[model samples]
Target: METMMLGVYKIPEITINSGIDWLGICGIVLTALIVVLGTWTTIKNFKNTTLSQEAVAEATSNRQFVHIKAENVAKNRQEWINGLRSEISNFISACFDVRSVYLNQSRPTGLVPELFEDFVTVENLERELKSKLIAAQGEARRCLSLIELYINPEEQASIDLVKTAQEIFHRAGDTSFNLTWECDDLVKIAQGILKCEWERVKQMV
Candidate 1:
C-alpha cells in the first residue's frame, strides 16, 4: 500500500513540470508576436512621413513655376510699351522739323529776277511739307495698330492721335490749305501720341 501511494505522488510532480514548460513556451511566443507588430508599425509610419514630405516639395515647385511665368509676362509687356514710346518720339520730332521748315519759307524773299527763284524755293518747301505730312500719317496709323495689339485702355487718346494725323494729311493733300495755317496742329498731334503712350505704359504693370 505505501509503494502504491509513492507512485501516485510521482505522477502529480511530473504533471506540474509539464505545465511549467508549456507556460514558458507561451511566454516566448507572445514576446515574438509583440516584436513583429512593433516593427510593422514603425515601417508604416516611416512610409507615411516620406510621402507627406514629397507632397510638400512638389507643391513648392509648382508655386515657383507660377511666379516665374507671371514675371516673364510682365517683363515682355513693359518692353512692348517702351518700343511704342520710342516710335512716337521719332514721329513727333519729324513733324516738328516739317513745321519749322514750312514756317521759315512763308513770305517771298529777293528782288526782280531773283523773285522767280524765291518763288521756286517756296514751291519746293511746300512739296516737302506735303511729303512729310503723308509720312506722319503713315507712322501714326502704325502707332494706332500697335496700341490695339498691346490692348491699350485709352481709346480717347488713340482717337485723338488718329484724328490729328488725318487732319494734317488732309490739309497737306489740299494745296489750298497748309500746315502754316494751323501752327499748333503738329503740337496737338504730338500731345495725343504722348497721352496714348502714357496709357500703354500704365497697362504694362
Candidate 2:
C-alpha cells in the first residue's frame, strides 16, 4: 500500500465548442448593412439639395438679365422718340419763319439770327428747307416708323408737300420762286403738318 500511494495524480480534460451562433452573426451583419444604407441615403439627399439650389440660382440670374435688357430697350426707344420730336419742332419753326417773312416782307423781331439770315431770299429759304427736310426725312425713316404706326396716315402728306416745294425750287428758270403767295402756301402747309405730327408725338410720349 505504501508503494502504491507513492505516485497518485489526477488531470481534468478541457473541451472547446467550435460551433458558431450563425443567427446572432447574421443579425450583426444586417445591422452594419442598415447603417451603411442610411449613410448612403443621407449623402444622396445632400447632393440633390445642392443641385436644386444651383438650379434656382440660375433661374433667378436669368430673370434679372431679362429685366435689365428690357429696361435698356425701353430707354433707347424713348431717346429716339425725343430726338424725333426735337427735329420736328425745329422744322416747324423754320416753316413759321418763312411764312412770317413772306407775309410781312421783313424779318420778324423775335426771329433767331441764323433763321433771319437764312430766309433773306427764296434761294436761301429753299436751301435751308432742303437741309431741314433731309434731316426730318432721315429721322422719320429711321426712328419714327414705330411711332407712325399709331399716327394717322394722312400725316404723311406733310412729307409730300415738302417734296413738292423742293421740286418747285429746282424747276430750272421757273419764275414762281419769288412769288410770295406760292412760298407762303408751301411753308404754311408744311407748318401745319409738322405741328400735327409734333402734337401726335407729344400725346404718345
Candidate 3:
C-alpha cells in the first residue's frame, strides 16, 4: 500500500501486486449494475408489449361479434318481410275467392223447380258452392293468423297493420264489403313497414 494526498485527504493506493485492485473491482460492480438495469428494462418492455397485443385481440373479437350479430338481425328481418308479404297476398286472394263463391251462390240458376233432375242438380250445386266457400274462408283465416304472428306488437305500425288485417278478415264474408279499398290500405301499411326495416338493415352495414 502507498499513500496519496489530495488537498487535506490522504488515501491508500491499491495495486495488483497488493492482491486487491480497487479500480478493477469498481469496474466490475458498475458493469453488473448496468446489466441488471438493462435486464429490468427488457422485462418491463416485454410486459407492455404483451398487454398491448391482448388489448388489440380483445377489441378485434368484440368487433367480429357485433358484426355477426348485426348481419343475422338483418337477414332475419328480410325473411320476415318476405313471409309477411306472401301471407298478406294469400289472405286477400282467399277472401276474394270466398266473395266470388258467395256471389255465385246468390245468383239464381235457370232450372225448372218441378223437375226432379233439376231439383237434384240445384241441391248438388248448393252443396258444392258451400264446400268451396268454407275452404276459401278457412284459407283466409289461416293466412290472417300467420300475418298477425309476423307483426311486432310493440311497434305502432305493426299494431295498425294487425288491426287492418283483422278488420279485413271480419268483413270478408259481407257481400257489400269493399275489399279492394281495404286491400289497398293493407298494402300501403305493409309497404311502409318493409321500407323502414330495409333502411335499418342498410344502417347496420
Question: Among these predicted structures, which one has the highest lDDT?
Answer: 3
lDDT of 3 by residue, 15-94 (tens): 76657888999999999999999999999999999999999999999999999999999888888878998999999999
**Runs in model 2 with CA error above 4 Å?**
1-11, 101-205
RMSD of 1: 7.4
Q: What TM-score does candidate 1 get on C-alpha atoms?
A: 0.54
By TM-score rank, best first, the candidates go: 3, 1, 2
Separately for all candidates shown, the number of backbone clashes (residues 3 or more apart, or on different chains) is: 0, 0, 0
Winner of 1 and 2 under TM-score: 1
How accurate locally, in lDDT, is each candidate? 0.60, 0.55, 0.91
Task: Give the Å shift of residue 108 in candidate 1.
Answer: 3.6
- Candidate 2 root-mean-square deviation in Å: 10.8
Best model per TM-score: 3
Q: How far is candidate 3 from the true structure (C-alpha RMSD, Å)?
A: 9.2
Q: In angstroms, how far off is 162's CA in candidate 2?
A: 9.0
Which digits, one per residue and each the tens of the lDDT, describe model 2 over residues 100-176?
33444333444454664644655565566566555544443432343334234465565555554444334312334
Work out the TM-score per prediction. Answer: 0.54, 0.48, 0.83
